[model samples]
Target: MCGIVGVVSHQPVNQLLYDALLLLQHRGQDAAGIATNHSSMFAMHKANGLVRDVFRTRNMRTLQGNSGIGHCRYPTAGSSSEEEAQPFYVNAPFGITLAHNGNLTNWEQLKEEMFKNDRRHINTDSDSEVLLNVLAHEIQKATVDISIDAETIFQAVTVLMRRVRGGYAAVAQIAGVGLLAFRDPYGIRPLCLGINETEQGNEYLIASESVALEGMGFRFVRDIAPGETVFIDNDKQLHTRQCADNPSLNPCVFEFVYLARPDSVIDGASVYSTRLKMGEYLAKKIQREGLADDIDVVMPIPDSSRPAAIQLALALGKEYREGFIKNRYIGRTFIMPGQAARKKSVRQKLNAIPDEFKDKVVLLVDDSIVRGTTSREIVQMARDSGAKKVIFASAAPPVIYPNVYGIDMPTRDELIAHGRTVEEVCREITADALVYQDIEALKQAISDVNPELTSFEASCFDGVYITGDVSREYLDKLENERNNPTKAAKPEDAGRSQLNLNLANEG
Candidate 1:
């Protein structure tokens, strides 16, 4: 849901954070922060906005240091203000600058427990801050100074593991020591390590995704496995520790469905390939479901659906056409946040060409439909373009449930498919008909890739939380809360922001 980076080198590495943030800006756009520790001195800066907007061109090199970490935040349990921003500095016996991606499921309970014991203070309601407190408390528990070496950090982290639950892909800088990185037991999120062969020596870099490493001119090493923590000390020694591991990998299926970048490979699967497979599967599913295949052409919604539409066209032996052109200047709807911004963005985000669909049966393919509004707008555009018939196809199933993880989808009323059938949804969106890829087919398409996974969090479609936060009982509680907003938990303090982020390892 966010991007995080860490670097440990012989020379200054603050620029590494800047470059890495540039690469990961697509992952999160709400806020950006960078922190560094050079010769035991810590410096940090965080603000609400895009990476470029938060850290100006001149300020990129401000936090000069050999050890550093950066975060592009997608708030899980935090506000869209600088107060909740990351790179949290907990000043005490020693300092730690930490940034994180992914949300913790048991945050509310943990915070209450922390208050019960008075072990830590809860501020801003950000899970990242809670995680920082956990690590800081763990460090304080140790007899040896954890700020000096990798072994001490590993030991501290192993102890901290006993206190927390849910997912985390974190990078932290410990003064006079080094940089540390780790992922949760389920390996629900991706983390990659790389090394830069520099004249000074070997500089190690870690990021949430491999693409960031490539962008930073670092050679990809390998993934940092779930339940494993890696520490790089001042001496540049890498120490490893294990907390727990659930070999049955059930990563969030939405990563391939729509969240991750096409060029990025998540859990060893090419995102582009998986998207194409969704198209191929949908093509066959349409045939099985006994739908008319008299479409003159297959059209993509543009950008994300380009590859998928091509695969669909090839499978159906229909011509592929670019029916819509996105306004590159319009930012993503989710990034804008709030309902008014989303509605406004939808109107300005896309444009349709009449020549492409005149008198033809246009089959529309898209990654996923968050709210039915955009699809409705696209349908109107298609009609205005003179398409005789517009058939909608979603590569993933209908989004009936709101995503609390980081996608900014909230409330059942916002989801047009929440209580409506697919047929009814088609009517609502003003489409002739709508066909979604079968859930099983979607699973096969993604799992067919290398390093197979048994299960994944697909709660967005089926309303089932396999891992991070919500349980069936909790889901019922949520439904109750949604029905009675007056009785619901305060939106600002709601822990539901996490969704089921790391549930694959719950068993």
Candidate 2:
């Protein structure tokens, strides 16, 4: 997954985009980029680093524009290369730049079609670039004039909705025209619209999470509807059209379990409250199984599982302790690009406090266990720290299937629960006992918070792809890509680098 942001304002948006990217840094840490439109000319800069490292004062000064779009990239479709960093720009179709938050399952098919039918050559393996080329090609076909109108844009997006078959929350800048944003038909990813009204005028923002809107002094307007295309004219007029004939609003359940921040709300459901309910539900399960009697202390695996651990401890009448202390400087291990990187970062990211774990029968709570790599390491850390017994509890159900939407898990063999039973998994992780939230109970916990949300994309746990197109062959291809080493780009070939690329000068 990634984070995408678009802003159309009356003033220069360099700082606004920067500040918003900081809030979304958690969504992606592999790479960051921003593209701004100035007088029908595009200036773009991207690099392989966090937002703070990628953009500087000099770089921001060069990115002069009142309207811009930004992206924090997590590698799901392409290799972790600076060349794959987004907001991907195409000079054709009035200099369009696009950034997206989810993966396209039919990317290879679209790439071949673009090359054979549309005569467009994609330079990078990044799916966002392919998506941009698709949009530009469709927009060029639908437009009768130099400037694209709302009807033409909506029609192009509608065609796009049919062609792309995966989850996407995308934002694009149409140079002289304005900003455009759209969501996949399934609404499998999160996208929300917000507005900031000032004496100068009203500024519009589109983000993957509501927290970015709230952090940027923007009022949460509402979620952009499933399969909806939103267009903001240069005059700040907003036009919207439902592009999909039959759209379903099933946001990814993993977003509530771990992906999104607790402060954010998606589809009228609070992530914080959902996690709390998950803790309560898990607590009930612990009581039902009579495991709480042996768990002397409920300890959280710092940060993500704190809410659930707190509630679980309260429900079990056990002491809540912060056993693991995280190093704030380290990036999130879960979102790391490679398995080796993720494994290496886990130890650096967290350390167990001996005083808290010593002589205690600890019950550790985490969001979810994907591959059990980190869980095994964490369990070892607890033992080394002198815990008498270590019991692992997950707020989410076991991830048995590969997530095709945006998460990096692409192979079933990588999952610890793919063929192993609960006892086998417990033994593998070296924990005294392992317990996971029941799938039905998890659904109830999330839905009880907001009855309006009837469905969720829980493909990882339940192995049900909501898009209905993911096949065994497609999954095998994705797994091959994950296992193979990506061809690294040369330093000079890295797109744009820290310096701004002026598309006008290129032409």
lDDT of 2 at 232: 97
* TM-score, per-candidate, Cα-based: 0.91, 0.95
How many backbone overlaps does candidate 1 show? 4
Best by TM-score: 2
- Residue 395 Cα positional deviation in candidate 1, in Å, after optimal superposition: 0.6
Candidate 1 lDDT over residue span 110-203, tens digit each: 7787778746777867878888878877777663743345556667787666666655789988787677888877676778799988787788
What TM-score does candidate 2 reach?
0.95
Collision count for each candidate, in order = 4, 0
Candidate 2 collision pairs: none
Q: What C-alpha lDDT, on a 0 to 100 scale, does residue 220 get in candidate 2?
A: 99
Candidate 2 C-alpha lDDT tens digits along 1-507: 999999999999999999999999999999999999999999999999999999999999999999999999999887888999999999897889999999998988899999999999999988888899999999999999876888999999999999998889999999899899999998999999999998988889999999999999999999999999999998999999999979999989889988999999998999999999999999999999889888889999978899999998998999999888899989988887667987898899998889999998999999999888899999999999999999999999988878888988777778898788999999999999999999988888789889988888888887677777775555555665566556333345434322121221133
Give me candidate 1's TM-score against the actual structure: 0.91
